[model samples]
Target: MKPAAHVRKTALPGVGTRYDLNTEAGAHLSVVVHQDGRRIISFHDPEDDDACKDAAALAPAEATALSALLTPDPVAHLHQHLEIDLVTEHIPIGRRSPYAGRTLGATQARTRTGASIVAVLRRTDAFPSPTPDFRLALGDTLVVVGTREGADAVAELINGG
Candidate 1:
């Protein structure tokens, strides 16, 4: 049988219910369901319990969309609960994108922006764990993960900064 996860439930008077989960990897995550249908998700710093490394306040629809992304793939769900304060974003390669016809390695996105391109979505096809040699094309959407700032920097770099 699979091991059970450690979680704590807290009630905030007039605010909402908060669920704190401690992952097996030693990462901390918190989800607050507000009284007004908003959801706040946050990742805490492992070294400092009082510090929040990353957080996002999501509307009901946005929460649903996030749920959809995490539901089908167990790996994706697991990564979401990991200790890293990283976020996943889909960044599109536009017509003016400098890296459209270049190899992924040529962009050096990870080295330059600290974000890693995990996959690519081109038309109806999905390429998971794309190699550095992968050739990018216009309209292709890059699936990247890192700090929010890192992801944004990647988008900026891909668009010629």
Candidate 2:
């Protein structure tokens, strides 16, 4: 029988698992998955086929960020979305806005907007993780996080719409 034409999988004690495969061009590639949701990808040093030189190691979040690169070129898809966009936006408060003179609690931002106000930026001051009791001001800019639709809801809630 010819050499097994499949990637080899090995268990890494106290760590996680490892998978290795040789490309048709004879280059060896390996990926190690750690129990902590981290991954290390490597390529064998061509000069020494017996040894692998780590190419990159990524934490779970970093890997997810890297996966975003796999999507189609963004500039080409500008009018069209390549993926669901979860974004952070800074929304300013106006004097007549409901959030202007009230505490965050009274607004029930999360309950009404389905978005999170993570922080607020006032003139020369920034409040992170502002509590529900924190009072809002006319010039305070809320740093919100959520999908576009959710953010729209938050804008409407702030403006009493």
State which candidate has the highest TM-score: 1
TM-score of each: 0.50, 0.48
Q: Give a tens-digit lDDT track for model 1, residues 16-129.
A: 999998888999999999999899999999888669999999987578668867665557668866888888888889988989999999999999999999999887689999
Residue 40 in candidate 2, Cα distance off native in Å: 51
Candidate 1 matches the true fold with a TM-score of 0.50
Model 2: clashing residue pairs? none
List candidate 2 segments past 4 Å from native.
1-84
Q: How close is candidate 2 to the true structure, as a TM-score?
A: 0.48
Off by over 4 Å in 1: 1-83
Tens-digit per-residue lDDT, 25-138, candidate 2: 978888789998889888997668568776799876456556656555546656465575776777778776977888989888888778999999886689999999999999
